[model samples]
Target: MAEQQTDFDVLIVGAGLSGIGMAAHLTEKCPGRSYAILERRGNLGGTWDLFRYPGVRSDSDMHTLGFDFEPWRHEKSIADAPAILDYLHRIVADRDIGPNIRFGHKVISADFDMANARWDIVAETEDGERKRLSASWLYLGSGYYDYDEPYDPGFATERFEGQIVHPQFWPEDLDHAGKKVVVIGSGATAVTVVPAMAARAAKVTMLQRTPTWMFARPAKDSIANFLRRMLPEQTAYRITRWKNMKLQSLAFKRARTKPQKMGEALHKRIEKVLGENFDAEAFTPPYDPWDQRLCLVPDNDLFEAINEGRAEIVTARIEAFEKDGVLLSNGRFLPADIIVTATGLKLCVAGKIAVSVDGEPVDFAQRFYYKGCMFSNLPNLAVVFGYLNASWTLRADLNSDYVCRVLNHMARTGADMAVPVLPHGHGLEEDDIFDFSSGYIQRSKHLMPKNATRYPWRLNQEYLVDRKRMASEPITDGILEFSRARQDQGAAPEMAAAE
Candidate 1:
């Protein structure tokens, strides 16, 4: 029998927002490079599909959250999960890229065949049968969500709980109506679940050790809608996207440089709704804004719930869980019929895939990120990581175009491998992947990718700066070492003709 060959020029992992957007980019920017997407799940839309919890929606504005190429024509700037899923489906259908995606193919590992300049991918089908595929480049579109198992804090143990639920594994039939509910954690999940359940529940309480800053934004973008009606589709989208981008950038910088100023403004906004009872010390986070992501309550739903006395906030440490409810460290008890542990997501890097380079196990943390996409010493591989500060798709769009540019540059040079190499004594300070204080990131501890001090190596979370570096920047900066193909036999018969 003839040897099995690598099937595509690029093999994309995970079929979510990132994966779909990547496919669209490759289709438009590098039409000649054939690619295949391997999705472990039987369906598309990663987070929008998996997260079935109540009020699942984007915290960021749709103007920035939506793709650069696609226009978000919806009235609601903050979209629900189903709507987002529908949007993704429409894009896939419109671009005619659905056929290229193979569902139920879970990529477990990738062994780089450097001699032949291809990757031998090991994946298992939905039926648990092992299979292999290969590609010239592997783009990891698998997001950082911990799908297999959510993070259990190991501290909230109780013997006589009615029901303890994690939003990740929310039961469809678990009705919360008329029942007293207690949501644990101070992050976006808790904020969302509280009000959603409050609408039907007897009473809801948000229990947090430390409070997170919450702001209210309009659910619908009236200005964006007006502009869309007045101007062309792309033009309207460009204007709205940039407007949000600049505003977000400015706010983030102000939060960093002037925490007190931002904090005061936040307190004032909430006080206008809650009046005098709103506790500044209780609601105000110890860490500054952008240290942990600020939570957005669209149309002030969370505040409305609080104002209506349907939901209440309790800022205290949990001594432990009791039979009926939770016991506070400061000698207090909160009753609950249902407990929702919206603690946080467990960060997963590179989809937790065991990747090797030329038969050697890749130590990812030791390596620095090359422009937040490619890793140092890693060849022809780009991992899709988004902005820690801004909307994820913003950075994702940049990454997609940059990846195509690198591929095109390689084709022009007749190069098969493009690896990042740092010079000796580059004198770059290594930094953490994110400076956020969320429990998930803190628990991850050193497992995340590193950042260098200097240009090209240090990934900028700023979109304005990225526009110059990721778009107009030259590829041949003496960092990316390019070379010709090692061999020609690995490519599939269909891809054998590609440059």
Candidate 2:
């Protein structure tokens, strides 16, 4: 029942892309600092390890998705789950990060002791054993979506006689070969699952209430492959990463500024592929391009499946799930033996960990985001919520680098606590930083932290501008206040029983 002591200088939550990347940065940039990664799951690789559905792959290219410190040697820029896991494993092994990770340790709550300037952490194992731990600083890389549950569209599954599955929890024993499979939803998951299950399933149908904008591109980056062959591994990786980042930025800008033109171009591309059988209504979304994320169909796999008549798209309202399959509002019934709900993810913030400061609960929605990593008035804490338009790791890499710089700065200045202080009467306009119409984004918009109109206070979407600003901007910009703990709080508490 005694108070737990600080166990590590930094306690990083989650062992996913962001967590591992942050640990790697710590090793390189702030070598003397001691850190530990607490992962709730048994294994690492976060999303890659969690998702077991067929044809699971990255929507973003690997050149940009891979860590900035590590060179991505994989040939396919659009990598599958296994390959991505392998890459992550290699990073852990090479960086000696495996020893620093505590698996099956789920963080339940974290309370920052303002007097001591340290965080008191409570984590529970899978078996429900609670352990106390503490750290000088906390970093949350727990990802954006809920790991325990996927978004439920409130489908009445009891009416269906056949098997039902959600892509988030794909059954290992389930077989689709020769079965009529229908995937519900038009997001990236549905797009990936339809083509993947088409080769085996007798017929794969993608059922959607509304059309989602789609873009087709080759799975392999020809330019990256060529550069890899000609140039050294590291050099090629750097060049390819830079090139892809620029291209991604340009594409997003065009989509935002010229949505009509971009939408038309996407439509034309789909028309060229689908040819005579192209359904304009099914391919064209009511909203503009990048309104929701553009579904990236690598190698035209989704289109190829549709073109081959193996998979089809049904753009209609689901009246109900009948005994055999889904009955549409238009009086059309789609027959299916197996149904996979590729319905989107349920978004979560800070891994749903209960956070507080000096017994006062921290409601992130009321606080403003500081430098897209830290929050206003939160001491010794940083959270990684990556980019929506570009690769998630792009922001992950930047945030990790920025955190490392902050950590090093703190050590140099002998400051025990650092918090972004927003004074009253500060003239700052609130802005909707997410600015996306995606269902998940819209659903969780109220849960997210506030953002200002200017730099350092807002979560900037443009990576190029962020990269320069993060690299060059001074840490002591008066906004982020740094201070030492009071001597009256007593000497540093000794280590408690920590897992």
lDDT of all the models against the reference? 0.85, 0.90
lDDT of 1: 0.85
Output candidate 2 Cα RMSD.
4.2
> Model 1 over residues 1-499: C-alpha lDDT tens digits?
1224338899999889889999999999999988889999988999889888899999899889899999998889999998899899999999888988888989999988777888999998889988898998999999986789898888646564689889998999999999999999989889888999999999999999899988888899988999999999999999999899999999999999999999889888888888866878768888887788889988889888998999999999988788898889999999888999998888878898899876787877767788888887778899877787888898879888888989999889888888887655557787666677888888885777778667678667788898777777788878788875556544421111001
TM-score for all models, in order of appearance: 0.95, 0.96
Best model per TM-score? 2
Q: Residue by residue across 27-113, what tens digits does model 2's lDDT show?
A: 999899888999999999999999999999999999999998898888899999999999999999998999899889999999998
Off by over 4 Å in 2: 1-6, 488-499
* Candidate 1: pairs in clash: none
Which 10-residue window in model 1 sums to the lowest lDDT?
490-499
